[model samples]
Target: MAETKTHRVTVAQRALLLSWAGVTDLGRRRETNQDAFLAEFPLFVVADGMGGHAGGEIASRSTVERLQAVVSAGDVNGPAIEKALEQAVGDIADHPETTDEGTGTTLTGVFFAITGDHAQWVALNIGDSRVYLLRDDRLVQVTTDHSVVQELITAGKLSPEEAEGHPYSNVITRAVGASELTAPDYVTIDVRAGDRFVICSDGLTKELTDYGIQHFLREHRDPGHSVDAMLAAALENGGRDNVTLIIVQVEDEDDSSSPIEDTTE
Candidate 1:
């Protein structure tokens, strides 16, 4: 199922409009769907659970449940997010069903906030899940994968094409649980009207290319439509893994002007 909601919030005393929708599906090959997400305002997240059976499901559920408390209390920042992850770590460790050494989940998404006097978008990531930004009719990936193939590509030892088919493509170097605590990489960007963000697990990318994602976003103006289209397409293309998606679009409540496209820092 897909859900859409609009939020009116203030950032640096400036009111902004934030709208988003999210969806998830168990692919053709997975016996258990071990993915979870939260698409609430100020925070939108997707987590692709790893390990096996109940392990992945518990890890993912614990993660979002912990983060959900943060959202309820309205303290969302790097440290706060880290604190939530710490709680999630504990949740996974205590779960009796999660015994696999590889049990964990990928957490990736963008959040809206006010830093100092300006409204900002903060993107965070761990593992192979991704975040992409669409502005000025161009879509660009905002998060880098922490996986074996990514390391090879960064070291100039593997081509992008070859990395796709490599046997180590699914091996992630970092995650939220699985017996280790790792910090997620965060990129802050200026908030702008007409800017859209796409957050998803590796399952979506495994089925759809960046170009395909861009095309679907262009084809749909509403968040709900965009999410449904992409989810359907991912499954049609052979959803080999559990797929998840979140579409977030920002707008200035006071103006209908075009979005400003600035490079993220």
Candidate 2:
């Protein structure tokens, strides 16, 4: 078993702590893992690629690499991310592996930003990969899927249950490198302690339900353990596709106080 990698960052002004862990598995059926992720502070992302013959792998890896470079340069805002994603698209489109097959990848994750005295969590999504939030003991999907089945469900033509089993469930309407320009949906939320965020590829959700994920998160308080449990559950269910997940846990430093006692004992 390999050791899980963890990254921890702190918001200096507010003493808010953010810790994250990421895992990517080839799964039980895939010949190659086309999923890529970034778990660095202020920037975490998950990219699930499409197209076969290693095209997907190249697309996804290129997307994450571009984003990582942008983040390392200190541009961690919505517009900066969008620009990076656009460049990533061009990079993948120009690659030899994807030039003919037309490869693309889903990009989704959260970016931490601080403005004045307020700290915010920025959620970005494109395609079927998802971002979820577990707060107040409730787990809810933060990003909406941009897929054929998702559109049908929105139009009331299909129920969530039916859409899950639909043959075209994996047909995403939006993805990086799929077109000339790709605009991602972005939402900013106020950061709070005890807020747990999960960014993952569709492979994880396909195997585990929201309730199942929430149960695992609630059972494991540590981000590393939570990620391990969730990934294990997904593989156990049926590792149909490449599975990848990132778990971010926010904490308040002030909440760790302990009572003082007499000096001599």
Candidate 3:
């Protein structure tokens, strides 16, 4: 086993402060990691690609690269991210590797925006990948899935547990690069000290139940350790797909103004 790698980002703006870490694994089955992520401060993302061969890898990598480029150019709001995603869709469509049927990738994560004198957490999702919040030792899923199973669950045609093993569980109704334009769902969250957020692909959830996830999260306070534990648990349970996650913990700058930390295997 290799040592886990962790990247920390600490940002203090106005009355809000944030600290985040990210991790990704190819999992026990996949020969290639079709998951991509961006953990830069003010912007964090996880893209899970679909389509066999190298198509999935290209779709996810391109989506993240374009979004990162847009953020690096000083645009980090919902509209900016949306435009970046649309452009990514176009770029993927133009790629020769993409079939006429079109390859796709699920995008989900959070970005920070300044509202009044405080920074707000803007959560976004376009497919099955999800963003979750943990506060007061309780875990809450923030993003709704855009998959067939989720639609069935919402229509009351299927129960949550039944949807998990449904045949169409991986059939997403929305994805970046699946079409020329993709609209993502966005929500602004109130930020508070001790609020922890988790952004991950369906791979992790496929192997770990919500209760199991909550238990592991409640047991680990450090973002890096929590991420590693989650990934390890997923693999132990038979990693069926690529696993990726970003764990962000909010803290008051007045409580501690620590610099960013990085650790590698």
Q: Identify the runs in model 2 with alpha carbons over 4 angstroms from their true place.
A: 1-14, 256-265
Model 3 stretches with alpha carbons more than 4 Å out: 1-16, 253-265
* Every candidate's lDDT: 0.88, 0.84, 0.81
Question: Can you tell me which runs of candidate 1 are displaced by over 4 Å?
Answer: 10-15, 253-265
Residues 1-265 of candidate 3: C-alpha lDDT, one tens digit per residue? 2233333333443234456678899999999999999988778899999876778888999899998897789768877888888878877877878774558899999987766545568899988999999877789999999988888888999999898778998888888875647788988887667788999999999998888888888888777788989999999999989999988887664653333221211
- Summarize candidate 2's per-residue lDDT along 1-265 as a digit string, tens digits: 2234444444443355567788999999999999999988878899999886878888899889988988889868878888888888778777877864458889999998766555678899989999999978888899999999999999999999999899999898888874556889988877677888999999999999999999998898888888889899999999999999999987776653221111211
lDDT of 1 by residue, 141-164 (tens): 999999999999999999999999
Residue 48 in candidate 1, Cα distance off native in Å: 0.5
In model 3, where is the ten-residue run with the lowest total lDDT? 256-265
Candidate number with the higher TM-score (1 or 3): 1
Model 3 scores a TM of 0.88
Against the true structure, candidate 1 reaches a TM-score of 0.94
Instruction: Tell me each candidate's TM-score.
Output: 0.94, 0.91, 0.88
What is the TM-score of candidate 2? 0.91
Please report how far candidate 3 places residue 51 from its true position, in Å: 1.4
Q: Is 1 or 3 the stronger prediction by lDDT?
A: 1
Q: Please give the range of 10 consecutive residues that has the lowest summed lDDT in model 2.
A: 256-265
- Report clash pairs, candidate 3: none
